[model samples]
Target: MADFKSIKVTKGIKTLEIDNPTGYHLIGMGAQGAVFKLSEDRCVKIYTSPLQAKMEREALKAGQHLSFFPRLYEYGDNYNVIDYFNAPTLKEYLRNCTYIPESIAMKLLDILGEMKKAKFTMVDAPLRHIFVLENEELKLIDHVNAFKRIHPVPLKLLRDLNMMLLKESFLSRVKKLEPKTYEMWQAYFNENKMDYRNIPVDPGGDGEGVKVDSAISQTLIGAGHQGAVYRVSENKCVKIYPKTQHCEQEKDVLLSHQDLSFIPKVYETGNNYVVMEYLSGPDLNTFLKKQSALPPVVSKLLLKILTSQKQAGFKQIDAPLRHVFVTNNGFKMVDHVYSYSRIQKRPLELFQNLHERGFLDAFLEQVKVLDPATHAEWTKKPIPLTDEEAQLEIINIEGKTDSKRKKGKDQGKDRDKGRDHKKGHNRDRDRSQKREHGGKRDNGDKKNRNRSKEHGRENDRKKRSDRIK
Candidate 1:
């Protein structure tokens, strides 16, 4: 008997490392643990954690009745001895083949049905975990979460198909053969505002260059603080920047990554402009606003872009929502000015933008389902509040402007009241002065009348005296 206790397993940042001192032949290794072939028909799987080993053992014991699952012979604290078959993984098969056949799709669906029959809550498995046997049959491994987690759909399986460019064909088969399941999946996608039928299989643009003249007039497609984009041809657009350095930076990034499917193909470069493939679609911000939901497809595409950028050795993996375009082919990102100069491990700006748009929670949920490791790593750190702060700063500026406007209005009202009060006071004073003047004139007239009457009486008396004399 081989001593499984002699084997040592250490947990790393993202995966487990194993130190095997025994004569067991190493078959495979993953984040959970390592597998070693014990015999011609059996293998032993050792887990880094006993809890995970226990979970898989129980799940395998429960699923032993199904032909798709391996037969378990024995299980210990952190290891399981199960029947093993030398077969290629579905991922490897797909890599060699151009497209998935209908028979394979049907078999996959049947496996899911069998899992459902077995009462496994999580019917999902990655392509790499499924082994393709000789008779077009499937065998699934890594049953740790089969009974523990509850997922309504095979999200991870569908994600794998999407990544392999085989989802459309598989869904077509589902739509014809398993209409009910297809409807359920479609409803789920619809709820998330995702159009799974039109998932991008290839990157947009042909490897062709476009010609442009600086003096020629072109239709202005977009304008921003950095530059202006104008449509020079039906399939090409020219982005002209005010600064040559900015143009040089963007052009260099684009030229270096021309083979990438999601990147826009570069045609020509000038002192301050670069002609590239014209991307025809709404920006990510506009799409989210229009749909009012963050679709799982968008989250997957964003994660894929980040992974590709990392693989291509880009330092800055973040992009604003406005810079990401949702085209018919796939998601395309523009503005690579910071991709080389800035060092960022995660897409903090993108997450902040999602947070500001009220889609952060939904995006994170999708991430948690599609890529748990990424979700763990991203949630482990704090997402910076730069976008939030920018939004708040805008609100504050508008608030201050409103307050100033209101204050100016109030001050104008106060000045108007003062002017009215002064006018009323002056009018009253003029009325009083007029009244006094009129009273004096009336008194003077009265006195003159009396004097005239007295003079007349004296004249009459003098006349009478003269007559008498």
Candidate 2:
């Protein structure tokens, strides 16, 4: 066996990398760490956390004498050396046999019986965790949790076996052979309905549950509405969610759309986080912005993607270009909340923003120039634009209409005020003329009175002169 001191372990996920991996063969891996085959008789388990490694080592020591488990030779802080058995795992057996016989279930119970006698208990024996030798004997691996008290009922094994073997065939076989035992297992499942493997841990935000890709120099890729995304490895990335429920919902969405080419493959899901295949390309919006023009090939690809999405019963075609990546594999949509969630529709701002950013015309031009046939067909039988986009247009039209109405009202008020002012001027002119005319008539009467008086005075004077004569 190689000295574990020489085996380089990367700190991020605590993955084991040999100085020269030429002779070593990778056997398996899990959430904790990995296992590697060193030779015909020797294999080693390496863990990411020292605590986990210590627990595994102690558990192995407690059951070192038990034949049902692997023989541990020596253990370090992060590595364990053990005898590698040349046999097929229970998972492989199921894949080949398609079903587990009743007799095999009985055999497993008998094996569990021996472990119970040794006071080493392991209830979570998924088919994948157990190995079956050519001699039909069994060797259970992953002894980390063996120290827990043995439950009278094998709850973990029952659930895991059912999940690993479709239709719960193994548990069902046990049920038929031992009705009482099956009832106990079924009762246990009902009581503990939660599957820890699928249960999400609250990511809270920063790529929750994300492990460092310590092997790489820089891992931060980008962020979205869900949370920040980080590159964990060459092939994997993690998206942390704002809320725990969002992670669960997103996981369900990803699983439902696994067949779609435009969506990323979801790997591991945490409480508020998801690990998925990392896409290697710039988003369409950024790419188009940088190019300042769209190529004909890009148009054809984008249309084809939208057409495929529509055919897949996904009606929302007005995808935000920023959520779209232009890769050689095809367009990969990293976000799917709008597609599968309750929203069920794309917002109109997606298109409006593209138009506002001056990319809509460029994209349309490419479509018209390159895929004219598709453009014609789409335009003629245009996909029904969502009501969301219409609301934006309505708001714009309403704003302009309100502005025009206000201006018209102001103009009307001004015109009415001008007419009133002209009428008042004519009234003033008439009043002045009337007053002048009255004054002129009074003066003429006065002159006439004076003339009459003078005539009277002349007559009086004539009378007085006559009287004097």
Candidate 3:
């Protein structure tokens, strides 16, 4: 080991000055300290402050059992000796490669797993600290924040990958191999408002535009009259239009409002398609269905969207409820084809839809409390139903009236038929009783005449008998 007393270390106001009389070649320098090569397999890092040196030594000692970490050999008050990797950094190695391979992704996951096993609170490291060996092995150099800070995911590593256009490819493997870890990382990213998609600013050269590879499979997420949206990756989607002008219109609108959090980041524009950030959540229409009542936050977000559009210089300050997506941060609007070209002063389409669904009253109440000026402007004219809605209502009312009228007519016909049959039966019974009574009277008279004739003959015979006596 080199003599520590001979090496002169000076701390400046905002920098560290190292005077090496021990003939150690300078290798690396950082905010904490400077590293010098001591031998073919080892190096010494001298810190500006003893505290940082002690912290790094403890971190190295905690991870010494892991193969990825440099082996710690010796330690002092302000210096420590550890293994030196004579290899290229991960950033340098990726410059020559077309894309990140799945093997590299697996190794990165394994390194994170090792960090977790070593009880590291911060399972993250910068790409510059990661060395790629000739045999495809990875080794980490700096151990300053390995056990000091807290990070649930490898955020630095992912950000570096995104810079190199390898993040999506790496995450695809992560999703397939370690689904649970993938979900956890996604949750962390969304909570932190970090976008993980590798959106290239200039994807093509010489004005040729980027062409989507034919072999890349995409799943259709949604479709509309103007275009269709396909999810190309976990965090990226492509909107395809029938005409190039339609694609250009939406792309321009997105680019103009890129600084707005509610506007999705547009990646690239093609002849008939545009790739952008994939916002995952239910649209406002679907979200409202699951809600028992229109939450005040939703109404506020809707008003914010319109205000943002107006501020962004869009003539059409309205978006259909289906185009607005509910995200963790707030609502994000998509499909901006008509935002610039159409002349819509207010969100009438949205209000009309809410009216039909019986949510307009509640929505307006929230808006009234939130922005009375906008409420006044919106309610200045009573929101009339759309032509289609008016036609449908008329059909429904007419149908009900016609059904009731037909039912009443059928009931009256049944009552009249019943009364006519009862009157005809009573009249026939009266005629039959009269005929039987007349026949009885006629028979009684005939009997009386016969009796009278017999009585007269008896009287004559009695008178003759009396004379002979």
Candidate 4:
């Protein structure tokens, strides 16, 4: 047996002459090691476990049959290297856009079809493992669950059911990949009397949890002590926890509410995450920066979201500003991963503290109007959003939306929008140049020629009059 801890690789481990060791820009992380960008186009995945590294190599070799996966450049005992594409992972692409487009999703189905044809299964098939390449081609990565068919094993029905559940949540994306792949795989498994023992099971949901990709999205927005927020779809945010317990707890609380518009919908949950809805526009903090001092109407909308959470009997809102996403309709409380604690006073204290700081007089008034049950605990709220109170809470954002912003560290400055602005400028310049080339250039030339002619005529007349005299 090979030592699973370490192995000395011989052929494929030559160091590229990079300015630095290279492969440090981390695109994603997993239980084993971090995946880093080798350059603008390639990536190197280093694993702590020698076993995992070898498995990665083996899978890559096997996956050569499938084109949607990365072209594995080289693999050894310590590291696996592959060519990277300019495409965003499904997790990141989902953030700014609503629903996976059929074109891309169908491509994913093609990749899945190849895997099934190889008699392989993705143990974890969440959004993270799926990448949307530049040409709307869906690529599947991280094949830790790849396996061959094994005959005459028990518990076949249960395994099939679990795989079915996974297929269901991602029905949209999966539909795009290859339609009969799953059905064909099922038939093959049944025909061979195969058991899915080698298939990795998702710990999220029930026995047959949907397979999820484990890659973290590049577009993660709000991060805090409890969890981080990712855009799952154009108008939805997936709040994932560092640990599984938090995800489970938040799912329970979110499922209790039925008003989908006021709250982002919870799609799925696992030990580490609750896949929820994402919203566009800005968080309360960003909105405040642009609008500068919330108008009464906006404040009311903000208050309405907070009050809804209050009505839902939530306590300990870790980051309230992050939870409140401002859209044209109103503010919606999008994150619930940290708010549903049984201890009610914690969130109430945060509300009172914000009120003292003048973060929300309108918010306080709305909460105060919360008939009996909700307001009963908030009596004698001493400090409101006063200067001192604001100063105090400034160090720590008190509510779920705000707390999401200031989980434990002093908030970092927002990323400069320079890159986005530059891209827009370049696009505009291209359009302007195209239009100019396609249209007439004679108007300015004609005006200039008329002026020159008038000046020349006046000069000629002066010369003629002088000669006649």
Per-model TM-score versus the true fold: 0.45, 0.47, 0.42, 0.42
The number of residue pairs in model 4 that clash at the backbone is 46
lDDT by residue (tens digit), candidate 1, 282-344: 667667876678878889899889889989988767656767777777888776754775456
lDDT of 2 by residue, 271-308 (tens): 76778887766666656776665566666676666666
- Give model 2's clash tally: 2
Q: Can you write out model 4's per-residue Cα lDDT over 1-469, one digit (the tens) per residue?
A: 3222232222211111112233144454454454555566666666666787787678788888677667788776778877665565555565554444666545555554466566565433445456666666666666654652222121222222222223233454443454464555446546654221211223232111123232221233444344544443445445545456656766777788856457656667665666665555555544554554436665456545555666667664333443455655566554454455433342433353343234544444565554444444443343322222223333222333333444412221211111111111111111111111111122123236657855654564355335434
lDDT of 2 at 291: 66
| Top model number, TM-score | 2
Better of 1 and 2 by lDDT: 1
Clash count per candidate: 0, 2, 0, 46
Model 3: which residue pairs collide? none
Candidate that scores best on lDDT: 1
Q: In order, what is each prediction's RMSD in angstroms? A: 38.1, 37.7, 41.7, 20.0
Model 2 TM-score (2 dp): 0.47
lDDT of 3 by residue, 33-70 (tens): 77776677887788888998999999999888898988
Selected candidate, larger TM-score, 1 vs 3: 1
Q: lDDT of all predictions, in order shown?
A: 0.64, 0.54, 0.63, 0.45
Output the better candidate (1/3) by lDDT: 1
